[model samples]
Target: MSFIYSISANTVSRRVILSKFFKQKRLYSSKRAIILGIETSCDDTGCAVVDTEGNILGEALHSQHLIHLNNGGIIPPIAQDLHRKNIENVVNAAVKLANLSFNDIDAIATTVKPELPSILFKKFESMYI
Candidate 1:
């Protein structure tokens, strides 16, 4: 299994980025690779399952815009808490939408932004590592 971390807001951009990454790394086989992407860099918890052909198998997103708006602005701690609360659900929803389990995924990808709080990594490690 392989792990690739990434951060992007647009679906098209993510595909492009992943394509380049896979190609540059020469990580391909006769079978198209299936990727699970997780994003929690900013105000949303997003997950998606996609194939090497740029097909979007499934996707889920949880936004914190409203909560932050209510709070006047994004607070790091609140954002971290929300990501912790939503990451699993979002990933599961995407996998479910794809009608496949984690066993079917070839690789896992996630956003690793500098501004991200450390607590989010703890949540991810507990779930996936």
Candidate 2:
């Protein structure tokens, strides 16, 4: 199994990273790997479960886009608070949709710095690590 946790807001960089993941997967494991990905970099909190074969087992997203839009723009404190409130539910929903518990997951992937808020990082760490 492999766990990739990092921060990169660039789409091109993300694609490159994912490509490398697939190539390395072949060198590292014989069995398909199940990955649970969590994203709380901004106003939205999201989670997804997927396998190396490009199959999406489950996913959930909690968006605060409209709230931010109403406020004219994103407020970091508000976004952080919403993330705190919603992360657990989003993660559980994704796991439930996947028909698996945390033990069934092979690895966890998340954003750890730069783009992600400190509160979210701590929250996720406390929940999973």
Candidate 3:
């Protein structure tokens, strides 16, 4: 019953999040579950929690735009480090804002795409703290 589109940031300009939770096998009743999403491909760290019905529970995002803008370009190492520094807090805040804890998340989703290297993908897949 919660339908909110929320976000938090330190240096991000804008974000447009639209994705659904990955389907999983269910041996029990057809109850809805939640998915947490993390994005840290380029210059921002974004997190969101959504339900099976695609309602956004809560979200938090941190952008390194000013840093990149000041630096004159997007440096991969700097972007990675910034993601490392802020991902934990961002994820935590999103779950908190949703009035839930990590355990409440039935599934997790993150960015893994063409432009990002394996390292970044690994971070999104393995690192949540």
Against the hidden reference, what TM-scores do the models get? 0.75, 0.75, 0.71
TM-score for model 1? 0.75
Tens digits of per-residue lDDT for model 2, 74-99 = 98888878888998999999999999
Task: Point to the candidate with the largest TM-score.
Answer: 1
lDDT of 2: 0.73
Worst 10 residues of 3 by lDDT: 13-22
**What are the clashing pairs of model 2?**
none
Per-residue error at 120 for model 2, in Å? Answer: 1.3
Quote the lDDT for 78 in model 1.
Answer: 87
Relative to the true structure, candidate 3 reaches a TM of 0.71
Task: Show model 3 residue runs off by greater than 4 Å.
Answer: 1-25, 114-129
Arrange candidates by TM-score, highest first: which order?
Answer: 1, 2, 3
Model 2 misses residue 127 by how many Å?
Answer: 1.6
Tens-place lDDT per residue, model 3, 97-125, is 99998657766655544243336445544
Ranking by lDDT: 1, 2, 3
